[model samples]
Target: MYEGAVQDLIDELGRLPGVGPKSAQRIAFHLLQAEPADAQRLADAITRVKATVRFCARCFNVSEAEECRICRDPRRDGRVLCVVEEARDVVAIERTREYRGRYHVLGGAISPIDGIGPDDLHVRDLVRRLDDEPVDELIIATNPNVEGEATASYLSRLFAPLGVRITRLASGLPVGGDLDYADEVTLGRAFAGRRDVRG
Candidate 1:
């Protein structure tokens, strides 16, 4: 337990996702011990991000402008669109540097338990993009979990009639991971996604 304002700070910090009571306590104490300038800098950065960052009107990615850098880039392949559940996923894919296409942020995956559904997502925006843009393929990059699978399936069915080729990111046992430790679903997917060896 802490004093009035310090306890309030801990309570507020605990509200952030992934931050628990202990972590919030640690962070609050750390901030208290930190130089006043450092605390002020953190506050300023948070304020700046909230004031400037907005979702890209085109692809819904977090951006300071109307369109994100990827959407604005002329070098990116506009014909291929990768759909992901969140803006963080876009960063993940970008880190790979293998994909050279644009992205669509779905906002979230379908989770009935969480009261999120297809309508709750940005599916309509995606359909509109398909019509407005010259997209040749849609790569579903949703996570391989239950919610992600449902979202992917719903998207596949919805976009099937639109004539845009739909594909999913492959999932399987990770590199250097032993087969014995792999889950059945992942192992099955690995076998299902196997390719013929070539010289």
Candidate 2:
């Protein structure tokens, strides 16, 4: 138990996700030892992000403006929309360079354990977009996990009546990964997603 602001710093750092007590203590001490300018810059950056960054009104992605750049871009296909669990997932999909469509950020997946449901996310906004926009297809790119699957399934049912073509991202073993090290679920998905080689 440290005294005064030192303990306060450690406690605040520990509140960050994935930051344990030891890591928080280390970070607090490092900040204490850091050059005043560097620490001030870090504090300023956090403050600036909070002050300037906001969710895009269209896709809910982090943006400085009302809509994200992707939403404003004219080149992207407006008929195709990729739905993801979070803003970070948009960044991940952008790095792939394979998809050329716009996106809809769900805010988060439906997790009953976390007390998160479709109502808790931006799902209503998505349905509204589908109704208002000319979207013909929706790509579900949620993470390949139990909660993600449940969320996808729920979305599939919810969007079924809309008559839009809904698709889920295929999950399988990574390239160059050995079969022996693969989990049963991953191997099974690989088999299910396999396509016959074209001559």
Candidate 3:
């Protein structure tokens, strides 16, 4: 256990996601040992991010300006819109280099257990964007968990009547994964998503 400001630092660090008490303590000690300039730089960076970063007006991804780079890009496909639960998901998809369409971040999925629902998310904004934009295909790139599934289903039902084609990101066993180690749901999805071999 620490004392005074040191303990306060540890507690605050522990509040961050995935940081346990031990990890937080270690981080706090590291910061204490770090040069004053280094600590000041970290503080300045956090303050700067909090001051400048805000959600994109159109897509809800984290942005310094009114719209994100993706939303501002003229080269991106306007016909297809990918929907995800968070800004981090946008980074993940970008890393894949498989998609060239713009994105709409939902902020979060519908989770009754967590007291979060469609009303809590950016649903109304998405609907508004749909009406205003040229999007024809909405790809639900939400996680494959229960909350994600619920959000996807709700979105599909809500948008189906508008005649816009909606699709979900395909999920199945990962490459190099053994069938014996796969769960029933994953194995089933793999079977469902199977394609014929031409070779």
Candidate 4:
């Protein structure tokens, strides 16, 4: 029912992931009715993030510099690498404070139906990092879904001959739930119960 810029804003917002048309309309109206300063701040924040953030050169996580803070931290264990499907999963694991290792953000999981393959992700970078670093173990923290499983399996096979230990996060995660959404307790348990991937 809205016109011009207001409807345009709703349409743009609706295109974002997880935002339905109704939710987008609600948000557009909320921004329109809110103080100009408040809306401006949100817009500025989004703009700044898009402009300033770059992927970490080492781990592929979002960062303002060539390397992310996690990759630069001397305290994190270089001998252990936690492989995740996305950068958001790095934040989720960090919140638990239970892991003191480094991470590799794969960017996306293998989805044959969607035409995403092993080469489409950061798997090559991960393998290169292993060749350069002294990583003793690789913890696969991909989600517990079909695509995630395929990605994990692919990685396991790729890394098998390298002699590094490969482990997968335990099940009992909410079925079809993204790793980014799992609660700290459940996520921690999965980490603790990680099992070796035997080839």
Q: Model 4: residues >4 Å from true position, as ranges?
A: 173-199
**Which pairs clash in the backbone of model 4?**
none
Residue pairs with colliding backbones in model 1 are: none
Model 4 C-alpha RMSD vs. true structure (Å) is 6.4
Clashes of each: 0, 0, 0, 0
Q: Write the per-residue lDDT of candidate 1 for residues 1-199, one digit (tens) a residue.
A: 6889999999999999999999999999999999999999999999999999999999999999999999999999999999999999999999999999999999999999999998999999999999999999999999999999999999999999988999999888899999999999999999998999998
In model 3, the runs with Cα more than 4 Å from the true position are none
- What's the TM-score of each model vs. the native? 0.97, 0.97, 0.97, 0.86
**Candidate 4 C-alpha lDDT tens digits along 1-199:** 7889998999999999999999999999899999999999999999999999999999999999989999999999999999999999999999989999999999999999999998899999998999999999999999978899899999999999999999998765777899989888779877887779999
Flag clash pairs in model 3.
Answer: none
Q: Report how far off residue 172 is in candidate 2 (Å).
A: 1.1
Q: Model 3, range 22-76, lDDT digits (tens) per residue?
A: 9999999999999999999999999999999999999999999999999999999
lDDT of each: 0.96, 0.95, 0.95, 0.94
TM value for model 2 = 0.97
Q: Which residue ranges in model 1 land beyond 4 Å of their true spot?
A: none
